[model samples]
Target: MEGPPVKIVALAIQGFVGQVLLDAGGNAKVNKQQFLHQVCKRIHSIGKNLFFEFKEKSFKLHFLMYGSYRVNEEKSR
Candidate 1:
């Protein structure tokens, strides 16, 4: 089955938080602050990877077999 429509996706990601978490093997030269206030130009997925593209940077998210995510909802710790 297909996923939700693109318009719904866009509305869900309308803002950006000014933080980035890098992997242990990720590029050391990348400045995480560069993403602050930068607009997300596009969003797409390839295979199991989800990509968020900015003007000068992009990040990819890949979930493990049982990984999951929540949007606009807070989980009590």
Candidate 2:
């Protein structure tokens, strides 16, 4: 089945961290594509954050910007 494409755009905020996007409500549209926009629409940040590109019945996530992060570190390096 073919239908109109869904467009989603999101902007990133500076120094924004510990964010999440949870689709608690299941898909209500006819198909997955219709309800997938919520992924990018529902985001918590200073300005804007989180993005998605719906393509071929799928989606691609993109991080416009990121906060500084490190792992595997000791108390004193």
Candidate 3:
């Protein structure tokens, strides 16, 4: 149980295409809340941490600055 047990934090630049079309100015950036909601919902399908344990364990994830991802896992009690 002391293995690395690696967890991947992947970041997908949502709307990278749309961003190109929208004249920067200030509206090219993605919507943080919207993107977070989308990522959360998608992850929920597989359950947070991709564990899919809806009733047993509560899985949660967060998005970092500038469209970055941060995945963290700890020993489950």
Candidate 4:
């Protein structure tokens, strides 16, 4: 698939959020299910930018001026 569907977006967001909240020195920690629920509760958001880091790699997704979509996913990169 070129541009992933909304489901993929949701999955990616969930993963990103989970990684961002991984084991910390404090006690405020959440499990996977709770994280997903809390994240999905954000019914609204602004901007077309998303970013995350995993392992030693980083990712940044920008939906462009048109909207949160991609007609040519490769070129968009």
Candidate 5:
């Protein structure tokens, strides 16, 4: 099945406050709390990795096999 359109994903996250759960990979020294209250400028993906772009910084999220994510959803017990 095809996933949602990129524009839809962007609309869901763009201009919304975001949080970082872990430091970004490679040499980037991204503080986990740095994204707090920052508006997400855009969202894109390459291969299995997703990216969240901000005004001065961007983050990458690499999903492993079978990995999944949810937006605006409560955690299941």
Candidate 6:
């Protein structure tokens, strides 16, 4: 059986806000959760889906999906 080959695709799209942050600084003081929160806030303000996942080293956030946006701030029961 042939297994799935590893692949990585980077999109070079325009209009990415806070692109400079990808280089360095401003986020060192904040924790992972804090950074995620801030990003989520910004995405919500712009009405977009805040897709995120955390790995061993960093948190990955994607805000490309704009149509089916939803912000869940309600406390879980």
- What C-alpha lDDT does candidate 4 achieve relative to the native structure? 0.37
Per-candidate Cα lDDT values, in order, are 0.53, 0.29, 0.26, 0.37, 0.57, 0.26
Query: Candidate 2 at 58: error in angstroms?
Result: 0.4
Residues 1-77, model 2: lDDT tens digits? 01111112222332222232233222224344353333332423223333332232323232334422122333354
Best by TM-score: 5
Q: Give TM-scores for every candidate, taking all chains together and pairing residue i with residue i.
A: 0.55, 0.18, 0.19, 0.29, 0.59, 0.17
Candidate 2 RMSD to the real structure? 15.5
Model 1: clashing residue pairs?
none
Highest lDDT against the true fold, candidate: 5
Evaluate model 1: give its lDDT: 0.53
Could you tell me which 10 consecutive residues in candidate 4 have the lowest summed lDDT?
36-45
Give candidate 3 regions above 4 Å deviation.
Answer: 1-42, 45-53, 67-77
Model 6 earns a TM-score of 0.17
Model 3, span 4-66: residue lDDT tens = 121332123222322222111222354333332222222232212322122222333322223
Candidate 6 lDDT, 1-77, residue by residue in tens:
01111011111112333332222222235454433422211111212223222222334333343221112233346
Question: Where does candidate 5 stray beyond 4 Å?
Answer: 1-31
The per-prediction tally of clashing pairs is 0, 0, 0, 0, 0, 0
Report the C-alpha lDDT of model 5 over 1-77, residue by residue, as the tens digit: 12344335445665454554332223345664676556666677665666888778778765555545566565577
Ordered by TM-score, highest first, the candidates read 5, 1, 4, 3, 2, 6
* Clashing residue pairs for model 4: none
